[model samples]
Target chain A: MGFDWAVIHDNLPFLMRGLWNSVQLAAITVVLSFPLGCIVALGRISRRRWLRYPATMLVHALRSNPLILIVFWFFFLVPILTGRPVGDFASVLAAFVVFFSAYFAEIVRSGIQSVRRGQLEAALSTGLTYAQAMRFIVLPQALRSMTPSLATECVIVFQGTTIAYVVGMREFLHTTFLVTERTMRPVELYLFAALVYFVVCLAGSIFARRLEGKAGIPR
Target chain B: MSDPLVSIRNLGLRYGTFRALEDVSADFSRGTCIVICGPSGSGKSSLLRCINRLEEFQDGDVVFDGASLRACRDLPRLRSEIGMVFQHFELYPHLSVLDNVTLAPRIAKGKPRQEAEETARRLLDRVGIGDQAGKFPGELSGGQQQRAAIARALALEPKLMLFDEPTSALDPEMIAEVLRVMRDLARNGMTMLVVTHEMAFAREVADEIVFMDKGRIVERAETARFFSAPTAPRAREFLDRILHRL
Candidate 1:
């Protein structure tokens, strides 16, 4: 099949708009999931059973199910159960938040646990409360170690944004699909979409490595 | 005398049926230093940690400044009055030596920034690392890191200080620098509980010496008497072993 530069040129603006939407979705999901994941991670590692058990169950449950199924649950099942229609964008965002937070929580838990036990003991012995110790001492160090992993997760989340197309969210892939339908140029359009994903993810991985180097934490 | 700054009454601890400490009790009078020395796994470190509630004990209680640790509602407040330095130094790798020293005072004690910084500087100077304040823990030598850890512990102006083999992680030449700083602290009348294998430090600085074995304190006496004429056979054997090693 011959590539059509003119067709892509004609649809460039529309495709760019879809890319913006995808970026926004990924950004919001990532930003919101970070604090939520930290809380969940703290709960997962808490000494209290009330916090630990629920957090453990939630992480496992969300992680076990496929991301597409979670998107479907929010898009279709929520409205049916609540008897109120949820916006397509909101439902998709909610699903992303819920689904990605489970993974993020595990990252955060590992990050926090990676901090030496001596760090916690030092903070505590200095008369800092547990929360204060976490905020000032543990979290800063933990989060630094977590940067590379978290960057990788962001790339994964950005790729996962393509899945939102199934729920009719007009993200990059969805926009590309619409263009291909009208123009009948499936191969070229899909190739272009793949190129965009490759570039963005490659940039993300390089940024992650630079960040790990800057942190200078001994392996 | 003055109700002792800290009193440990029959402290007991266990780890899944392996007793780490049993009936370990002692009183730390104000401005006095006590040295606890024993072979590995003798519960000396565990006994020191229990004073600050770093390790939880199942039986008995520690009374600090007349407040029972078990009944004290504000543990952080109680802890703020005490300082602890670790064998590994435990300096926050992410923070500068200055920030590490100032963190507890600023965040935990709610000291004003100016005041905390001043106190931190004074402490860093006192520990003989005034020039190293801007350096991260990774940038400092082992002895320098230990001194910074001491400064960090002292920033809160604690009534008591606990040292858990603070010089054990240092090189032979580096150990003397840390010991000198600790010796000054002892001379200045800081109430200290030290767990170490440093027999010379125990002899010169400790007001009293405690010897432990198999999770129990086997001997307690004035530092001179304990070194010159230990009452317990275990303590005598330990002293002989350590002295010969040195």
Candidate 2:
């Protein structure tokens, strides 16, 4: 079984479409979840029980469950409840949005916590309101600390886009599967898919590390 | 005599089950400098924080500028009028020294950028860190950072200043630089309530020296009298211990 370059070369266009779908899923999820995560993180640490309890439970609940299960739930349940058939892309995106937001919430919560307590006190004593303090002082510092962790989470979300395959979305993995079935070259196609994921995620990790080095707190 | 700028009456504070302050009373008259000295956990910092309502008290009241802090509707406004410097110079590390000094004025007072920068520059110069204005806090030495923190506090043009062991975190060599800036502020007649262990600064710059032990004011007297003849045995012991270390 010689390695077949012909199949990949012929199907490059078809496979690129799947790759584009994966990229879109990851990019949209990252954009949407980052802010959603920040809000949830704030709720988790809020002084009021009313805000804190539900946020804490939502994060914990989502984190404990598998990502694929959420994808299944959104795929099966959203249409039944809404009485309208949502597209496969929307179903998978919703699942990723809900699932990754919990992880991001934890990351952001820890980042916010990492800022010195004295920073908040200093800001407050300067006559800045609580909102002003968080916005100008705390969040800037917190976001800096969050970068490395956030970058790692982004890579995870990108990789997790593979699970979109189960929901019948023609993302990278599903496209690879279809190609392998058609060409009877499962091993070659799957290996190429893994290579693509590795390259993207590894680049993301390196970029995150460089950013972390630049923004890390001095001792 | 002018009315006291800050009047603390029977102030008591508790953290969980532990009492951090109990029945602590004092008066800080306008344009006067009062130095508070005490062992760790003797409620000096808590008392200072209580003046600005940074810490809630279970008993008594703090009246600042003839208005009760407990009853004051606008805490942010009250805090703007009273500047506090912490032991650790909590300069916003993400900001330039200039921005750190200008933030409160621009945000809290709604001062225009040009106006706030002018005041911030003047304050940075006043603290002797004018040249370091463009630098981030992490790039400056501890003394410079503390000085910048002072400038930041002063940019609000606060009526009263609180120093919570401002020199405690500085290097031994850096301590004098911070004390010098504080001495200058005292000489300029900025109403100050300082919690510190610098006996020399207390004797030189303080109008009154207050000594606390076990959450209560142990001795309060004119600086010369307190240093020369401490009435309380605890005050005498503390002075002896601190002086011996020096």
Candidate 3:
């Protein structure tokens, strides 16, 4: 296998475009999942059995399933059931959104639960409603504690965008594969793809560490 | 001529298989401090929590300023009127001291932000840590945190305040500052029921002191009389053990 700087240079713009699409998907998915995760967390922790049982079951089922299976189910199942063709990007995004949302919900639920019960009681005894206490007190603290886990989830979902290639939605890995097919240097192309994922995950880990420091996570 | 500000009758609280408090009954008149003292696991904290419905007692009645806590719909209003402080200064760590004190007032009492902030400022000053308003709970000393916890409780202007071993989490030096704040509240005629092992604070500030053992009130008397001459042997032994530690 030969190192072909020219081939790599030629594909850089297309790869960047694909990378941007992946990043956009991950970013929007993060924003979307956060509130959804919070709601799911609240539901799981609710006093009413009606709310808690179904929410817990949904989260448990999602968590137990593989990300690929989740993507396949949403992508294939939604179109079959609805009789409407959702766009490729939308299907991929929706699949990952649902997958990461359950993961993030577990993060949120544990974070909030890890906080002492006395804190919630204190908030309530002050006359705040359950929603008010959660909004003003519990969620803020839980978000702080859950930051590292949430960031890790973002990175996981970012890399999981590689799975979109399986569904034929051209992403970072898919773009690289196309270039490699033309260049015909499989080893070199795979190494370059690895490098891209490494740099992105490394950058995310560093950013998450900075956040942990700022939030005063105890050593 | 009027009902007590807080009343409990036949309260029996069970946590799973264990009964924390059982068949406990008490009445609290307005504007007096009631000190509850007991050995560890004696249902002192559980009793205080039951009054505010922080812990649900399976078979009992908690009437707070004439509202029944047994009814689910009335708990929020009842809880609003009855504030509680915990052993740990359960201040919201993410918020500033000002936000900690003001949040419930704004959210629960529906006070405007400005009014809440102003009230929070006043209460913070009353606790002698007004300068710490913008600081988070983690930044304050344990005593300051506990005092802020009290101020946070005060922000709602509760008709009754319950303290569940508030000073137990504090360092020796820190306990005094929190007790001073409690003393000040008592002086101003705040209606308070405290579960504490701080015998000095209890004796100095409490109008009535109730001693509990094994989920029941063993003795009840005025603070001086109870400390001077506890009628029950359990109360006497408990006081002796406490005095030995102090």
Q: For residues B13-61, could you state the per-residue lDDT of candidate 2 as single tens digits?
A: 9999899999988888999999999899999999999988889899999
Best by lDDT: 2
RMSD of each: 1.5, 1.3, 2.2
- The clash numbers for all candidates, in the given order, read 0, 0, 0
Taking chain A of model 1 alone, its TM-score versus the true chain A equals 0.96
Please report how far candidate 1 places residue A136 from its true position, in Å. Answer: 0.5
Q: In model 2, which regions exceed 4 Å deviation?
A: A217-219
Residue-level lDDT of model 3, residues A1-219, one tens digit each, is 447656667778987888887888888888888788878888999999999998899899998998888888888988987799998788888888777878888999999987778778888888878888787778777788878888888888898888888787878888888878877866776787799899999999898888777765331
lDDT of 1 by residue, B100-212 (tens): 99899999888998999998998899889999989888989999999999999999889999999998889999999999999999999999999998999989999999899
Which is better, 1 or 3, measured by TM-score?
1
Interface C-alpha RMSD, model 2: 1.2
What would the C-alpha RMSD of candidate 3 be, to one decimal place?
2.2
Q: What is the C-alpha DockQ of each candidate?
A: 0.67, 0.70, 0.59
lDDT (10s digit) by residue, model 3, range B123-229: 99999999999998888899999999898888878888889899988899999899999999899999999998888898889999998888988798998899899
Which is better, 2 or 3, measured by TM-score?
2
Candidate 1: lDDT of B43? 95
- Model 2 pairs in collision: none
